[model samples]
Target: MQSFRDEIENPIVQKEIIDLEKKIYSFRNGQIDDERFRSLRLARGIYGQRQEGVQMIRIKLPYGKVSSEQLKRITEVSDKYSTGRLHITTRQDIQIHYVSLDRTPELWADLAKDDITLREACGNTVRNITGSELAGVDVDEPFDITPYAHGLFQYLLRNPICQEMGRKFKISFSSSEKDSALSYLHDLGFIPKIVNGEKGFKIMLGGGLGSQPSHAELLSEFVPVNQIIPTAEGVIRVFDRHGERAKRLKARLKFLIKDLGRDEFLRLVDEEKKALPFHSYEIETAAFEGPITEPLLAVPSVTIDDVEAFEAWKKSNVIAQKQAGYVAIGIKVSLGDFYTDKARVLADLIKNYGANELRFSLRQNIVIRNIKEENLAFFYQELAKLDFVTLGYNTIGDVTACPGTDTCNLGIASSTGIATELERVLATEYPQYADNTGISIKISGCMNACGQHNMSEIGFQGMSINSGKLVAPALQVLLGGGILGDGKGRFSDKVIKIPSRRGPDALRYILNDFEANANGQSFLNYYDAKGEKYFYDFLLPLSDVTNLTEEDFVDWGNADNYVKAVGVGECAGVVIDLVATLLFEAKDKLTFSHEALQEGKWSDSIYLTYAGFVNGAKALLLAEGQKTNTHAGIIDLFDTVFVETNKIELSSSFKDLVYQINKKEPSEAFAKAYIQEGVAFFENIENYRAKDLANA
Candidate 1:
């Protein structure tokens, strides 16, 4: 571990790992607060799982793009640090479960060697930027969104504005108006648009799905390519200032936009423009345009023993790219779970026979790109060895599901268990759906909707039914949800709830009904024509829990009877109001401010200094039993409680001192001065707190 830590080339990343190690030691020794430690670890992409004393480390793969070398490196780390399995998230990141907290830093160092990161994959920070899997190859796309997604990810990583926001932020880029990335459900979603030959995007803001799904509103008809960073920065600034902090469920950007009207929110974003570091940040797209790398080894000659199976696989998995004579191959990773050994083979296969890059799709599948038309059979034969040549790639049989009770803390029932059963039902009963992409099915462990159940034509949310003193795992059936393209979509309506064992029957009923009455309409249109109540009427019998047997009490994939065991969810980092911890965090912020100044990140340095000031003030405010719910509120309250009362002395009012961040540009001179002042302010706050403690 020490050897790899020494070998880490990036000074910033090395320091981050070292700091994580030190923090872990502190946490183990009872020197750090549990909530504070959770926040720190989550920012580094180490998340707490349902099981005790283990973690799920999410490896951030920007836009789901992974090179052959990076894939090999991930497999190596997974084999060493976690279970030899990888779970592809709906957001296009890879997660490995059951990692020890103590060894996370070393594991991170290993992944960093291949330029793969775990940073910001979880926590109240800007998460991995997801994009359409077919961004570069889509025939209908105006231009590829790969570079923009990559550029935005690079800009926001470890950036001060989003690091400590009230809640996590999500961003997505769709390749075209097709909205394949599901733009309507992201905090900030972009769809490629060419306005009079100038490349730009139609911006959608404040979209999210959870217990309360909110459709994104149009932020702008068009934003030029270069102005995206500035736009994102402004929106984040406003969200950070006024987003809900005390209420975890209401802390998302969508809720903020809802509380403050869109007009007022846009006004706040406009106000933040003066303080932005860049008015127009041009992205370099050339590097992402062509083939990542030519195949080093020739395509192996192969013969298919089962020609019928091979043809069926190719019909669903093969996707033609916009580039002439090239295609992309899709691998249907069931429930997003794949072993590391198969992943190693896939890495080598892509490197040797095709372009050395592949993307993990938003539906938790793999897409290998740049394969030659003539080489399809060979690639298919190679994939068949690993059992990757499934019949349905993105079709109805390709059910998307979260880990559910298998790993997630908030799971009420088994999602993967039911999803697997439903997929089997589709393959056996409705084989024709394998080539149909019109109807999509998704499942979530709970209402948090990690599997994105709310935006599919058929959806199920994990739930539980109480039968007097006994409990049975159950699922909530939802219907009529579909994306309408161009940053528009509808959330599924909850239809009925049934026992987990009855999930297969529920799907059978729905499919049978659709087939009988649909009259050749699209699934969404058919669902709408019949209405939500119509489906509920037919599926009502399956919801009966009065006659549940012993088998109904046992959840799918479990031998024991179902017990509703839910751990405290760490989806958003816990809120810590400890005065001492806040003071300690203030000092840490000051240190980061000095480091950012040394690195010449003026905007970052200035923001860090501002955060330091706010944190120090909030510590004293909390000591006085005052509320510090938002940064703006903290600034105002600190002045009234301390500065005006003459309890603390400052050169100016606390509001003026902290508000200097947005009043001036992020120049080197201002950053240095702000950091120096922040350091002094920390000293003063510490002295005041000590005296107050002595008096008490």
Candidate 2:
């Protein structure tokens, strides 16, 4: 087989591929630890599935933008490597499942030919940087944030700082204050703003959705456009320095900010500014500027069999672009899964009729932009032929769901199953809501919220109910959660838990009540007026397990009895506490610090060295079976357990040694000294571990 090393042109990418191949070989041969291997593969977007030996490859498309060529390329790769099915995630990445682990490198190489990447798509690194799907063309946007979002993604991808963080970090950009990108649920949310006609962004920090959802705090009302990168770097640096590590659930930036208090967190962020590579990294928007296209051809007169159906589709699916004489079309990808054959047809249709570029929305749908106004009928007809013309683009009928038991290891129930059923209920029973954009529905198989259920107007989280000795699949129905725009949102309140089979009935009851009493108000307004208790009271009967028939025990889309089987989750990767591995990683960080110093990256060198110190200390702490939760905690515990106890001697406290990065400017002198400190720390830990092993 031809190696990717020869096929890939970029030296850096080639080296990355070669390294992955080497690591995979080592892992397969048992030369690498299982936990360490899991982390490595996850960082490269090769995720383990519930069905062992197969992988789920997540292709990272920054801001969900994909050209016709790229989409076709993806389809080709999917067809060759796995099932001809493409799954779009809420973060706007595409995933292909049941892939052989050995073929991932080949699959990735094929993707890179079309400028697609899989790096950092998973694991405790910066996930795909998402932005408004309509960023460039949104009429409400002060300016196109496409360039800025792309710029940030470029700056952070494969950056040393976030390569191996405590947990995954998410960032998003909204085109306007409407926050269509759902900025409020991201780790760092950016909304475009204009200050005296100068571009800026209102920043939101530490927002996340998991089992426990917390709204992001407003980090800054407005920061100049040029400062976005630098400010983001500063925030990441702080997160790296202090974010929790030991506990998987509490490791998110939101928890860190909550624990430290927002004021302290911001202070730390401001303190890291001096170490930033650039004080103002101005983004060049030339690449993302509006493309010049040929004049639109005359509208083709087509006989419509159902004018009313076509009009409804137009009202819900077509969005007016800021660019005059053009529009954007939204294609509701049911449950975000589409076959490769249809994908190819859609790709060709967009390339021939519309702009060659398209973006996948956070709601797991596609938005084809720059379509000539006159081509709407023609485009609809072409799309209808492929069964891609769905009327409810972002309405309640358009449900977002994660691939729960179908693939996800953490899924307790079938999210996609229930989501499909609920969408059917809407289409067949509640057809009046075909164009109603007043509400949103989302589902997640687990509390990790991959489906982003916590931020939807109506949400369902997969759970299990214990009925006497029987445990059956259940849905935790939540209500009143949604984005309030401009870095504001609410987490859904769990109103009731019911059998998974009753999900459609539960939806019917809620919708029936809302339609009767809402008086044409939006779902959010009606929800607020009705209050949580009122809705809970209304849906209370659904929670009665005593009335469940044998069918109720069966999960959606499953004919057999539902079994609550949840495998290990790979979303956060694995925590490898092997002493040798930890020490080896510390040495690797020290080597990285030296490289950064040679490259004139003083701040990068300093931070790399800091990580070296933390890893080295964590090795010793793990040896003692001591808990190391955060970087701050590791430093403090190391001083007490090793340095102060005289098991290892140091010139100063471990806290002072590691925390020096915060006090001093990231000059060459300090960076050199810090690298030396890291080297000494690694050596000390190595010797201690060796001695301890000898004694054992």
Candidate 3:
């Protein structure tokens, strides 16, 4: 209470009010609109999100570590104004919704109290720094990267030079070879190691995923870890000085990295490192805890009988401690959906009943460290109230899924739903898969691919396909995805695709096959050795039904007369749903019927081709039209839809193109195609022509 009052006291509030009043005086003739203001802000690296009237603010949670004080502030601010739900994103960020724009200042003030804030949380800026989630706990790691992650976060947050760059940049730290952080796939990846008997990091440059995906290359080896800040500053300086400032879509670090060869890039980085502020002790090894805390609970003193399954739970669910007898218990939360009220209750319990330390895991789960055996039952009871404590912490559909169409306009499909469905199917057809601990599966809704599907033992990406007039749903299967336990790392391979509706069957078949073939190796290792040929050869036969008489309808995927076939993932939903609706009768909303036509404005023919777009640019056409509507709505929607459609050409191959909402710029060719497609599809609808290139 004393601390709260000391912090919120007065002159600060009045100073802020005066400052804001002064800033408000510079408004455009005292008549600025939200859109214009938003655009101006965006151009300068600010963002505005759509939630309720209350703004939904996104703040980067890089590498997923925050100070205890920061966490308390988050809770306090959230409770004061919000519904109190903090979403931990797949990119390792925290987002809060239902905040009023007017209250933004107040919210910011509260955040400032804890040295936390919303800087570069949106727009085309480098997001929060991310590090391996297990950085401080995984014993297999060479060293904990928490200090470095925080250090970099401090250095990068609103840095003057980094405030403006060619595009958003990403950085990751990996002390372990596991690469669970997926460092190779980021803009900057740091791998811990010892070179010349000196401990430091092997830094990689120019890695990212966007329209074009590229892995980073090694730039410097054994750069003392302490030199990270200066080395980073130099690299950013170079990027700031040299990265593309002309093309918006082509401005990513990957483009820069691609433009320069590995050797030259390294030379540049080395040259830049010369002027950096490097310290000798920064790269030295730092200590961290083990991956799993041993069960902190001691032997029971009373005659309390527990189920046999409890023993398995104790073994598989609880990780052992580096220290004798102390265990870390993982309590998985489905969808990471827990109430703020519940968090308070749990925090109170930890303070009074359990250990003081509570750790949040990347799997959208939470852990309580060092609980005495005698208090296990009591701790379990408190967690049960929040509906988070479960014996099956890592089982079934406790699947990792990035936010999709639900919140991110960038999504092509609904990943959360798909994850739920997959879990249901697996549980329905094969319960053992849920209980199977060896295989790790992940899913993503967009090419942003936050689920880290590329490295899962088995992974799925949401997609769509055109089946006549109906848009059929499907998933692309990625196999051979694996991360090193410690730095020998290789991501999995893409094996096949299957209909989304049939995802469960495909997963079961794949898992069962592994079960039978395993000569005692883990699922991931066995699948790696099983090779691509085995999977393709097995799944290929099911793609197109050869003969009606031979096709097994009982086990095969078929809704009515159409058989489901595999297709590309990511933006696949948009085009395929378009195709499916155009060809078949409607069973679901994806049909190309009146309901679909009514969904948006671009469903008309005037949108097709660049010629049509150029011709339709009659600014004041609403001057005399019988459409019975103003041009305002039409113009806004047209720009929104067209921009998304045109932006996916580069990475759509890897993305599910079911719907288009590209964050980058579209090409002339792409814009031409979009307009043409829009015009043609809408104009000659009764005599639809999607089978040929003329329509596609």
Worst 10 residues of 1 by lDDT: 287-296
Q: Can you rank all candidates by TM-score, best first?
A: 1, 2, 3
Candidate 3: residue 194 lDDT (0-100): 70
- Indicate the worst ten consecutive residues by lDDT in candidate 2: 290-299
lDDT of 1 by residue, 1-696 (tens): 357799899988998899999999999999998989999999999989899989999999999999999999999999999989999999999999999999999999999999989888899999999999998899999998999999999999988999988999999999999899988999999999999999999999999999999999999989999999999999999999888887899999999999899999999999887789998999999998755567889887788788888787778889999989898999999999999999999999988888989999999999999888889989988888899988888989999999999998999999998999999899998987779899999999999999899989999999999987699999999998889999999999999999999999999998888889999999998998999899989999998878889999999988999999999898877777999999988998989889888988999989988889988998999999988888888988888998999999999998888878888988999999998899989999999999999999
TM-score of each: 0.98, 0.96, 0.67
Write the residue-wise lDDT of candidate 2 on 485-541 in tens digits: 888888899899988988999999999999899998889899999999998898888
List the candidates ranked by lDDT, beginning with the highest: 1, 2, 3
lDDT string for model 3 (517-575, tens) is 98889867787687888987777644442222322222112224333332222111111
Candidate 1 total steric clashes: 0
- Give the clash count for each candidate: 0, 0, 64
Clashes of 3: 64
What is residue 587's positional error in candidate 2, in angstroms? 1.7
- Which candidate leads the pack in TM-score? 1
Q: Highest lDDT among the candidates is held by which one?
A: 1
- The CA root-mean-square deviation of candidate 3, after full C-alpha superposition on the true structure, stands at 16.3
Error of 3 at 236 (Å): 2.0
